[model samples]
Target: MSTVSTHVLDTALGRPAQGVPVRLSWITDDEVVVLGTGSTDDDGRVTELAPDGLEFGTYQLWFGVAAYAITSGQSIFFPEVTVTFQINDERHYHVPLLLSPFAYSTYRGS
Candidate 1:
Protein backbone atom coordinates (compact mmCIF):
# COMPACT_ATOMS: atom_id res chain seq x y z
CA MET A 1 0.00 0.00 0.00
CA SER A 2 1.00 3.60 -0.56
CA THR A 3 0.89 6.50 1.86
CA VAL A 4 0.34 10.18 1.17
CA SER A 5 1.48 13.43 2.75
CA THR A 6 1.43 17.11 1.85
CA HIS A 7 2.56 20.63 2.78
CA VAL A 8 1.75 24.11 1.56
CA LEU A 9 4.00 27.14 1.34
CA ASP A 10 3.08 30.71 0.49
CA THR A 11 5.77 31.86 -1.86
CA ALA A 12 4.77 35.49 -1.68
CA LEU A 13 5.12 35.50 2.07
CA GLY A 14 7.90 32.92 2.15
CA ARG A 15 6.23 31.06 4.98
CA PRO A 16 4.22 27.99 5.70
CA ALA A 17 0.51 28.40 4.95
CA GLN A 18 -1.09 27.53 8.25
CA GLY A 19 -4.77 26.72 8.73
CA VAL A 20 -5.37 25.96 5.06
CA PRO A 21 -8.08 23.39 4.60
CA VAL A 22 -7.15 20.26 2.71
CA ARG A 23 -8.94 17.19 1.47
CA LEU A 24 -7.89 13.86 0.05
CA SER A 25 -10.00 11.86 -2.34
CA TRP A 26 -9.80 8.63 -4.21
CA ILE A 27 -11.09 8.84 -7.77
CA THR A 28 -13.08 6.18 -9.52
CA ASP A 29 -14.59 5.98 -12.98
CA ASP A 30 -17.85 7.56 -11.88
CA GLU A 31 -17.42 9.31 -8.53
CA VAL A 32 -14.83 10.64 -6.18
CA VAL A 33 -14.54 9.09 -2.72
CA VAL A 34 -13.27 11.30 0.08
CA LEU A 35 -10.52 9.63 2.02
CA GLY A 36 -9.73 12.21 4.67
CA THR A 37 -9.86 15.91 5.51
CA GLY A 38 -7.74 18.21 7.62
CA SER A 39 -6.15 21.61 7.80
CA THR A 40 -2.52 22.49 7.70
CA ASP A 41 -0.70 22.81 10.99
CA ASP A 42 1.54 25.62 12.11
CA ASP A 43 4.28 24.17 9.92
CA GLY A 44 1.93 23.94 6.93
CA ARG A 45 1.84 20.17 6.84
CA VAL A 46 -0.82 17.51 6.73
CA THR A 47 1.12 14.39 7.48
CA GLU A 48 -1.64 11.85 7.16
CA LEU A 49 -4.26 12.02 4.45
CA ALA A 50 -4.57 8.24 4.31
CA PRO A 51 -3.37 6.87 7.58
CA ASP A 52 -3.93 3.22 6.64
CA GLY A 53 -2.26 3.61 3.28
CA LEU A 54 -3.84 3.32 -0.20
CA GLU A 55 -4.26 1.06 -3.19
CA PHE A 56 -2.79 1.76 -6.57
CA GLY A 57 -5.18 4.24 -8.16
CA THR A 58 -5.82 7.86 -8.94
CA TYR A 59 -6.09 10.35 -6.08
CA GLN A 60 -6.57 14.07 -5.60
CA LEU A 61 -5.57 16.70 -3.06
CA TRP A 62 -7.93 19.61 -2.70
CA PHE A 63 -6.59 22.81 -1.15
CA GLY A 64 -8.85 25.54 0.13
CA VAL A 65 -6.99 28.62 -0.96
CA ALA A 66 -10.01 30.90 -0.69
CA ALA A 67 -10.52 30.18 2.98
CA TYR A 68 -6.88 30.74 3.66
CA ALA A 69 -6.94 33.92 1.69
CA ILE A 70 -9.91 35.27 3.57
CA THR A 71 -8.30 34.88 6.94
CA SER A 72 -4.80 35.73 5.82
CA GLY A 73 -6.04 38.86 4.06
CA GLN A 74 -4.38 38.02 0.79
CA SER A 75 -6.17 38.47 -2.51
CA ILE A 76 -6.06 35.26 -4.46
CA PHE A 77 -7.08 34.55 -8.04
CA PHE A 78 -7.44 30.81 -7.56
CA PRO A 79 -9.88 30.02 -4.85
CA GLU A 80 -8.88 26.42 -4.79
CA VAL A 81 -6.19 24.15 -6.12
CA THR A 82 -6.75 20.55 -7.07
CA VAL A 83 -3.91 18.27 -7.90
CA THR A 84 -4.56 14.87 -9.48
CA PHE A 85 -1.95 12.18 -9.34
CA GLN A 86 -1.60 8.43 -9.76
CA ILE A 87 -0.25 6.03 -7.18
CA ASN A 88 1.30 3.00 -8.77
CA ASP A 89 3.72 1.86 -6.13
CA GLU A 90 4.00 1.11 -2.43
CA ARG A 91 6.19 4.06 -1.65
CA HIS A 92 5.51 7.21 0.33
CA TYR A 93 4.25 10.12 -1.75
CA HIS A 94 4.93 13.68 -0.69
CA VAL A 95 3.02 16.31 -2.63
CA PRO A 96 4.09 19.84 -1.83
CA LEU A 97 2.31 22.98 -2.97
CA LEU A 98 4.22 26.20 -3.57
CA LEU A 99 1.55 28.86 -3.73
CA SER A 100 1.15 32.52 -4.49
CA PRO A 101 -1.79 34.84 -5.03
CA PHE A 102 -1.65 34.44 -8.80
CA ALA A 103 0.12 31.13 -9.34
CA TYR A 104 0.95 27.83 -7.72
CA SER A 105 3.13 24.83 -8.39
CA THR A 106 3.23 21.29 -7.12
CA TYR A 107 5.75 18.50 -7.43
CA ARG A 108 6.32 14.95 -6.27
CA GLY A 109 8.48 15.14 -3.20
CA SER A 110 10.60 12.61 -1.38
Candidate 2:
Protein backbone atom coordinates (compact mmCIF):
# COMPACT_ATOMS: atom_id res chain seq x y z
CA MET A 1 0.00 0.00 0.00
CA SER A 2 1.05 3.62 -0.51
CA THR A 3 0.68 6.49 1.95
CA VAL A 4 1.40 10.23 2.20
CA SER A 5 2.18 12.64 5.04
CA THR A 6 3.77 16.03 5.71
CA HIS A 7 5.37 18.10 8.45
CA VAL A 8 5.41 21.87 8.26
CA LEU A 9 8.02 23.82 10.21
CA ASP A 10 7.93 27.56 10.43
CA THR A 11 11.46 28.68 9.71
CA ALA A 12 10.77 32.22 10.80
CA LEU A 13 9.21 31.17 14.11
CA GLY A 14 11.54 28.28 14.78
CA ARG A 15 8.64 25.96 15.53
CA PRO A 16 5.97 23.88 13.89
CA ALA A 17 3.30 25.80 11.96
CA GLN A 18 0.43 24.56 14.08
CA GLY A 19 -3.25 24.70 13.24
CA VAL A 20 -2.73 25.21 9.56
CA PRO A 21 -5.38 23.75 7.28
CA VAL A 22 -3.78 21.67 4.55
CA ARG A 23 -5.43 19.63 1.85
CA LEU A 24 -4.24 17.15 -0.76
CA SER A 25 -6.24 16.84 -3.94
CA TRP A 26 -5.99 16.53 -7.64
CA ILE A 27 -5.36 20.06 -8.84
CA THR A 28 -7.49 19.38 -11.90
CA ASP A 29 -9.51 16.59 -13.42
CA ASP A 30 -6.76 16.19 -15.94
CA GLU A 31 -4.27 15.84 -13.14
CA VAL A 32 -5.74 12.68 -11.71
CA VAL A 33 -8.86 10.59 -11.56
CA VAL A 34 -9.58 10.86 -7.84
CA LEU A 35 -9.65 13.30 -4.94
CA GLY A 36 -8.09 13.32 -1.44
CA THR A 37 -7.73 15.83 1.39
CA GLY A 38 -6.32 16.21 4.92
CA SER A 39 -5.50 18.82 7.56
CA THR A 40 -2.47 19.56 9.68
CA ASP A 41 -2.09 18.81 13.38
CA ASP A 42 -0.38 20.52 16.34
CA ASP A 43 2.90 18.91 15.46
CA GLY A 44 2.60 20.53 12.02
CA ARG A 45 2.03 17.21 10.40
CA VAL A 46 -0.52 15.39 8.32
CA THR A 47 -0.22 11.90 9.80
CA GLU A 48 -2.39 10.03 7.35
CA LEU A 49 -3.49 10.57 3.79
CA ALA A 50 -4.65 7.94 1.38
CA PRO A 51 -6.12 5.67 4.06
CA ASP A 52 -7.07 3.29 1.32
CA GLY A 53 -3.59 3.68 -0.11
CA LEU A 54 -2.47 5.32 -3.36
CA GLU A 55 -1.79 4.44 -6.93
CA PHE A 56 0.34 5.86 -9.71
CA GLY A 57 -1.02 9.35 -10.34
CA THR A 58 -0.40 13.05 -10.05
CA TYR A 59 -1.43 14.92 -6.89
CA GLN A 60 -1.48 18.43 -5.52
CA LEU A 61 -1.39 19.71 -1.96
CA TRP A 62 -3.18 22.87 -0.88
CA PHE A 63 -1.41 24.13 2.21
CA GLY A 64 -2.94 27.12 3.97
CA VAL A 65 -0.50 29.01 6.16
CA ALA A 66 -2.06 32.43 6.19
CA ALA A 67 -4.17 31.95 9.31
CA TYR A 68 -1.18 30.92 11.33
CA ALA A 69 0.88 33.86 10.14
CA ILE A 70 -1.91 36.34 10.75
CA THR A 71 -2.44 35.08 14.30
CA SER A 72 1.27 35.34 14.96
CA GLY A 73 1.47 38.94 13.74
CA GLN A 74 3.36 37.84 10.68
CA SER A 75 2.85 38.65 7.05
CA ILE A 76 2.50 35.92 4.53
CA PHE A 77 3.62 37.13 1.12
CA PHE A 78 2.49 33.88 -0.34
CA PRO A 79 -0.74 33.04 1.40
CA GLU A 80 -0.56 29.45 0.33
CA VAL A 81 1.84 26.99 -1.23
CA THR A 82 0.75 24.20 -3.50
CA VAL A 83 2.95 21.23 -4.09
CA THR A 84 2.43 18.90 -7.00
CA PHE A 85 4.01 15.48 -7.06
CA GLN A 86 3.65 12.04 -8.50
CA ILE A 87 3.28 8.64 -6.87
CA ASN A 88 5.30 6.08 -8.74
CA ASP A 89 4.96 3.10 -6.47
CA GLU A 90 3.64 1.71 -3.16
CA ARG A 91 5.73 3.65 -0.70
CA HIS A 92 5.34 6.34 1.90
CA TYR A 93 5.55 9.90 0.59
CA HIS A 94 6.58 12.38 3.25
CA VAL A 95 6.34 15.88 1.83
CA PRO A 96 7.90 18.24 4.29
CA LEU A 97 7.83 22.01 4.29
CA LEU A 98 10.30 24.46 5.74
CA LEU A 99 8.20 27.61 5.92
CA SER A 100 8.50 31.31 6.53
CA PRO A 101 6.17 34.24 5.99
CA PHE A 102 7.89 35.40 2.83
CA ALA A 103 9.58 32.22 1.79
CA TYR A 104 8.97 28.46 1.85
CA SER A 105 10.42 25.28 0.53
CA THR A 106 9.31 21.68 0.17
CA TYR A 107 10.80 18.39 -0.91
CA ARG A 108 10.17 14.69 -1.00
CA GLY A 109 10.77 13.60 2.58
CA SER A 110 10.95 10.21 4.27
Candidate 3:
Protein backbone atom coordinates (compact mmCIF):
# COMPACT_ATOMS: atom_id res chain seq x y z
CA MET A 1 0.00 0.00 0.00
CA SER A 2 1.00 3.60 -0.60
CA THR A 3 0.79 6.65 1.64
CA VAL A 4 0.69 10.38 0.94
CA SER A 5 1.86 13.62 2.49
CA THR A 6 2.27 17.28 1.52
CA HIS A 7 3.89 20.56 2.46
CA VAL A 8 3.05 24.10 1.43
CA LEU A 9 5.55 26.94 1.30
CA ASP A 10 4.77 30.54 0.57
CA THR A 11 7.45 31.66 -1.84
CA ALA A 12 6.41 35.26 -1.70
CA LEU A 13 6.70 35.35 2.06
CA GLY A 14 9.53 32.84 2.31
CA ARG A 15 7.77 30.77 4.96
CA PRO A 16 5.54 27.82 5.49
CA ALA A 17 1.91 28.39 4.62
CA GLN A 18 -0.06 27.36 7.65
CA GLY A 19 -3.79 26.72 7.83
CA VAL A 20 -4.09 25.96 4.16
CA PRO A 21 -6.93 23.51 3.50
CA VAL A 22 -6.02 20.34 1.70
CA ARG A 23 -7.90 17.35 0.34
CA LEU A 24 -6.96 13.99 -1.05
CA SER A 25 -8.90 12.31 -3.80
CA TRP A 26 -8.77 9.07 -5.68
CA ILE A 27 -9.35 9.38 -9.38
CA THR A 28 -11.01 6.82 -11.58
CA ASP A 29 -12.07 6.83 -15.17
CA ASP A 30 -15.60 7.79 -14.19
CA GLU A 31 -15.26 9.99 -11.15
CA VAL A 32 -13.12 11.40 -8.36
CA VAL A 33 -13.64 10.12 -4.82
CA VAL A 34 -12.44 12.16 -1.91
CA LEU A 35 -10.46 10.15 0.61
CA GLY A 36 -9.40 12.57 3.30
CA THR A 37 -9.30 16.25 4.22
CA GLY A 38 -7.03 18.38 6.39
CA SER A 39 -5.42 21.74 6.87
CA THR A 40 -1.73 22.48 7.00
CA ASP A 41 -0.26 22.54 10.44
CA ASP A 42 1.82 25.34 11.90
CA ASP A 43 4.78 23.86 10.11
CA GLY A 44 2.87 23.95 6.84
CA ARG A 45 2.84 20.20 6.62
CA VAL A 46 0.06 17.67 6.31
CA THR A 47 2.03 14.77 7.70
CA GLU A 48 -0.24 12.08 6.37
CA LEU A 49 -3.28 12.77 4.27
CA ALA A 50 -3.85 9.05 3.78
CA PRO A 51 -3.02 7.42 7.05
CA ASP A 52 -4.91 4.35 5.95
CA GLY A 53 -3.46 2.90 2.73
CA LEU A 54 -3.86 3.51 -0.94
CA GLU A 55 -3.85 1.41 -4.07
CA PHE A 56 -1.68 1.88 -7.13
CA GLY A 57 -3.53 4.38 -9.25
CA THR A 58 -4.07 8.07 -9.88
CA TYR A 59 -4.79 10.56 -7.11
CA GLN A 60 -5.17 14.29 -6.58
CA LEU A 61 -4.19 16.77 -3.91
CA TRP A 62 -6.36 19.85 -3.73
CA PHE A 63 -5.08 22.89 -1.85
CA GLY A 64 -7.32 25.78 -0.93
CA VAL A 65 -5.24 28.95 -1.18
CA ALA A 66 -7.94 31.53 -0.59
CA ALA A 67 -7.81 31.03 3.15
CA TYR A 68 -4.11 31.67 3.18
CA ALA A 69 -4.50 34.70 1.00
CA ILE A 70 -7.11 36.16 3.32
CA THR A 71 -5.13 35.48 6.45
CA SER A 72 -1.85 36.66 4.98
CA GLY A 73 -3.48 39.62 3.29
CA GLN A 74 -1.95 38.81 -0.01
CA SER A 75 -3.79 39.13 -3.28
CA ILE A 76 -3.68 35.72 -4.89
CA PHE A 77 -4.55 34.96 -8.46
CA PHE A 78 -5.21 31.28 -7.96
CA PRO A 79 -7.71 30.47 -5.28
CA GLU A 80 -7.07 26.77 -5.56
CA VAL A 81 -4.43 24.39 -6.78
CA THR A 82 -4.82 20.79 -7.85
CA VAL A 83 -2.00 18.32 -8.33
CA THR A 84 -2.65 14.99 -10.03
CA PHE A 85 -0.15 12.15 -9.79
CA GLN A 86 0.10 8.41 -10.10
CA ILE A 87 1.06 5.89 -7.47
CA ASN A 88 2.49 2.75 -8.91
CA ASP A 89 4.19 1.21 -5.91
CA GLU A 90 4.04 0.64 -2.19
CA ARG A 91 5.94 3.68 -1.13
CA HIS A 92 5.55 7.06 0.44
CA TYR A 93 4.66 10.08 -1.67
CA HIS A 94 5.51 13.61 -0.64
CA VAL A 95 4.05 16.33 -2.80
CA PRO A 96 5.41 19.72 -1.88
CA LEU A 97 4.08 22.96 -3.26
CA LEU A 98 6.02 26.17 -3.76
CA LEU A 99 3.43 28.88 -4.01
CA SER A 100 3.21 32.59 -4.66
CA PRO A 101 0.36 34.92 -5.50
CA PHE A 102 0.53 34.44 -9.24
CA ALA A 103 2.22 31.09 -9.77
CA TYR A 104 2.92 27.75 -8.12
CA SER A 105 5.03 24.70 -8.69
CA THR A 106 5.07 21.13 -7.42
CA TYR A 107 7.36 18.16 -7.51
CA ARG A 108 7.66 14.57 -6.32
CA GLY A 109 9.36 14.85 -2.99
CA SER A 110 10.98 12.27 -0.76
> How much lDDT does each candidate structure score?
0.96, 0.80, 0.96
- Winner on TM-score between 2 and 3 is 3
What ranking emerges by lDDT with the best candidate at the front? 1, 3, 2
Instruction: List candidate 3 segments past 4 Å from native.
Output: none
Per-residue accuracy of model 1 over 29-61 as CA lDDT, tens digit each = 999999999999999999998899999999999
Which lDDT tens digits does candidate 3 get at residues 1-110? Answer: 99999999999999999999999999999999999999999999998788899999999999999999999999999999999999999999999999999999999999
lDDT by residue for model 2 (1-110), tens: 67888999999889888877778775456554435666667788888666777767778777877877876689889888888998889899999988887799999998
TM-score of candidate 3 versus the correct structure, residues matched by position: 0.97
Return the lDDT, model 3, position 21: 99
After superposition, the stretches of candidate 2 with alpha carbons farther than 4 Å from their true spots are: 27-34
Q: How far is candidate 1 from the true structure (C-alpha RMSD, Å)?
A: 0.6
TM-score of 1: 0.98
| Winning model by lDDT | 1
For candidate 3, the per-residue lDDT at 37 reads 96
Model 3: which ten-residue window has the lowest total lDDT?
45-54
